[model samples]
Target chain A: MQKSRDYAEWYSRYIDDELSAEEKQAFLKYLDENPQEKAIVQRLQSLQQNLAQLPPTDTSEGFETVLRTRIQIEKKIGYGAIHTFFQRWRMPFLGFATALVVFLVFSGLKGIRWDGMPTDETAVNHASMQNSLSLPASNINYTLDQFIASPSYSTDAASIHYQPAEDETMNKNQGVVVDSTGKIKQETTKTIPENLQLSY
Target chain B: MEGREEQSKGKKPSDEELIARFQQGDIYAFDLIVKRYKQQLLNFVFRFLNNRELAEDVVQETFLRVYRKRHAYKQVAKFSTWIYTIAGNLSRTELRRRKRRKLFSLSDIGMEEKDYEIASDEFNPEKYTNTVMHEKIIQREINKLSSKFREVILLRDVQGLAYEEIAEIVNVPLGTVKSRVNRARLRLQEQLKKSL
Candidate 1:
């Protein structure tokens, strides 16, 4: 049964002329010895031939037209709608891009701010800090002069004002120290208890 | 309507080129793709279900999916393989729906289209020489196989795809495709002998 089953598989390949030369010779020899199975091979070949000759099934006469119409409906209903959307908007996008580049070039040549627009940074001091600071969580780092221009003093004259935490309390678990001004103060471990592992 | 299926030079763009163009928003590329594949896919799906209308619908759905998911196709795989996979999946799903529908479908209450079968002439054993009758019997036998055997058999014997290509289309190991196809052929041969 197993030998015949192998021969049956080989018959399929044989019909297709797929068996290698040596295998083909062997398959033919086996078929000669087994006349009954040769009929089976003839049957498979006839079926294949009939299927092959089974008139190339032409689709319905309007097949292409129908498909095209369906695709057109799809085009309107968001099939490739993204592609269509970009196509419809392409010229506008190019126009917008050009306008942006022109605006950028003009702005670059002039001061970054058009004369009426105030581009100057806002000045914040202790008063602003008290209003906005979450002291324990804040860590702002900027000099007042960096933001506000000093009329009498040079901008270099100002130093970074390190804001201390309100009431100088440090949140130990968070290991963060802040001030009423949102600027962060550097924390120093001023007192280290003598531990065996450490050198003074 | 201006479908460019083949180049004037008789050297058409590769499937990859067409799909790439489709991806780049060239609707005509999709037209070419449709013209190229519709008949073959219809034949495949039609043979799968043994129903012309449903097969055409499945092929359309397959193309629609291809249109929607053009970006999903990568250059790494053959476009035919990718599209065939879609058609095959849709065909299988339709087959299952048909089987389930057969059980409960009543002509009066069917929300779906009424079952229109290929009217195979009453099994006349002596009429085996009639080619039309033979074709009908063969198609019926194909549809009656389990979906796996039916699928591999169609791809191999009817479509004549290489075992390697069939493997990739069906997403199976090459040996599995060969095994299933051989089994299908053996069964088909037996049934056809009896029928004819």
Candidate 2:
């Protein structure tokens, strides 16, 4: 006689016809010797038959049409969701993105240094220009008047000579021509001939 | 439809062949596949969930998944196994959702009590009513089984699938599938005996 556990294993296989010829013969012998196992098998078989005979469940009417409509609606909703999302935020997002790109490009061109160092040689030149404008040393032996009378200043002033042209209309008075405000004219204006007047 | 019939006349294509045709852009082949398996899948899922609406939804989702993922169906596996796997996965997801809802809703407790009241309220407390009532008892017992045993048993007896196909659908070894089916049957039988 077979144990209930072993019979449990063989019962499904026997019903399914999966047992080999030798196994089937041995299972039959086991069932014959064990009335309890035979009764169990009989009960299982009856249960299987009852289950198989249960009322068939037909699908509802228009099932395929409903499924097709659902699929169509789903596909549309999927595509429409993406389209609506882009439509809603496209301008703002594009504007923000464009501003960001522009800001990045210009900032790259301006080259903001993040490492606490100067970005260009112009900073060094600025420092030197600032240094040149500082007050002279207090220990200097010369006053402001003496510094103004220095040879370098005198020569620099003399190099800039003002030569007046031959004035056709005012050639009669050439000695320190002064009329308005009694001030000596540095450069007298030359009168151009009527035929030589250039159109500016 | 006529074009499809004429294209593959006088011989019905296998599930794999239909699937292959679907992958190659034959829309009618997909229709054929859906028609072939819709009722079977509906019955399987209905038994698993014990709810008609939910079963229909699962089967519909299963076909939609099959349509969307037709290209993923390789020729190495049987089409029935692949489609059954999809249906089973959807059913499991539904079950998990139900479990979550039951956990969160106090009303579900009341609903369960009502269910018991309904089950207990037969024509007479002393006698079995009709075949329908008996089938209800059987269904309740089947549902009472743990999901693993319930799944293997339903796939075996109710769906009438081979052990090998069940193994493929459940993604387990053939031996494991066989053992589970046997154990499920034995457990179901014991439950029925106790109820009797």
Candidate 3:
């Protein structure tokens, strides 16, 4: 009933049952004296009663079972380990390892040039050209220019010219090349004739 | 058997003892802790969120957080204080997330009346008959209170926490908790009177 100026303190003490016998008596006397405050107190009592009457919440059914299962499953999945490790070290470790890897790989590959490697198509074409250019022993003296210029040379003939350079001769006096040393030479060139035209 | 009786009588384990046992992977000790406070925790969280499933989720998350952070727990504060702090933080976070997600439409909350009716029916048949009307009034009034006042009321009246514990749980001064609870109770009374 708010007889005292400190209604909040009185209410709090009343709820906790901390008021002394004399204080509670005085408070009840005050409530009896004030009609509006008595009404308010009545309302508060009703509210408390209603709150008390509210059903007790049922949390027992399968709650602990579910919790135990969850906790077990969580433990199986490294419960706090993953979370704790990540919280403490993930960012720094990830950053350090990533930087270390980048540094090591870059340092090791410093002189390597990936762009310089021949493409697959070019390597395959080159290997095929080398195979097709295999010539007979009788035609070994014919220069690649003469062979390419020959009237019999057709589209069916592989467009590769194999030449033995002069310095590559087995017998300098004979000016002839021999396979005794198994020596071979190769050159590749792509050309467009003057009469050919291209559209962009 | 004597010690087990004392333990069952709720002679709370010392923080160091609990911590040591938990560190040794004694989940039953953790279970004891959970058993001691789970209902109160559920009530606190349920009042905050007003949804049972969400409240249960918050409780689970709170315990999980506590378990994860158990190693960091210091004895400077009471274990209940630390646990409630975790629960309060998680509840606040979930509330904020719910706000951001905009998932709590008025229509969604309206559906709760039906659920409450269904839930209350299982408790007591006679009480359930009058529960709907009274519950609606109480729920509406409680919902009208500011979050601060609502929290104090729920903690003090519903959860039956002491003023000091409420202060620790809400992370406010003890005086503030007392004043808030008183004011909230007064406001609820006023609202109830009006509804009558």
DockQ scores for all predicted structures: 0.26, 0.22, 0.25
lDDT of 3 by residue, A1-200 (tens): 44356554576566567789998898778877876666666656556666655554556577777887787899899867787788899789999999999986674455333565444433433443443455442332232333333323222454333433334323223221223332323332222233322221
Candidate 3 residue pairs that clash: none
Across B1-196, the per-residue lDDT of candidate 1 in tens digits comes to 2225457547778889999989998888888898888888887888888888888889888988898899999988889999999999999899888778767766536432234343445666554544334566778678667889988888877777788888998999998988888788878878776655
Where model 3 places Cα greater than 4 Å from the true spot, the runs are A1-9, A18-26, A79-81, A85-200, B1-20, B103-140
TM-score for model 3? 0.58
TM-score of each: 0.61, 0.63, 0.58
Q: Give the per-residue Cα lDDT of candidate 2 at A91.
A: 100
TM-score of chain A, every prediction, order shown: 0.37, 0.37, 0.39
> How would you order the candidates by DockQ, starting with the best?
1, 3, 2
Report the TM-score of candidate 1, chain B only: 0.83
Per-model interface RMSD values are: 2.9, 3.9, 4.0
Which regions of candidate 1 fall more than 4 Å away from where they truly are? A79-200, B1-6, B106-133
Best by TM-score: 2
lDDT of 3 by residue, B1-196 (tens): 3335648898867655675677677766677777766877887787677778988888887777777777777877778778878888888888788766666566655564454343433334334224333665576677678878988887777666678888988889998988888788888877655554
CA lDDT scores, all candidates in order: 0.70, 0.70, 0.64
Candidate 1 lDDT for residue A33: 84
TM-score of chain B of each: 0.83, 0.86, 0.74
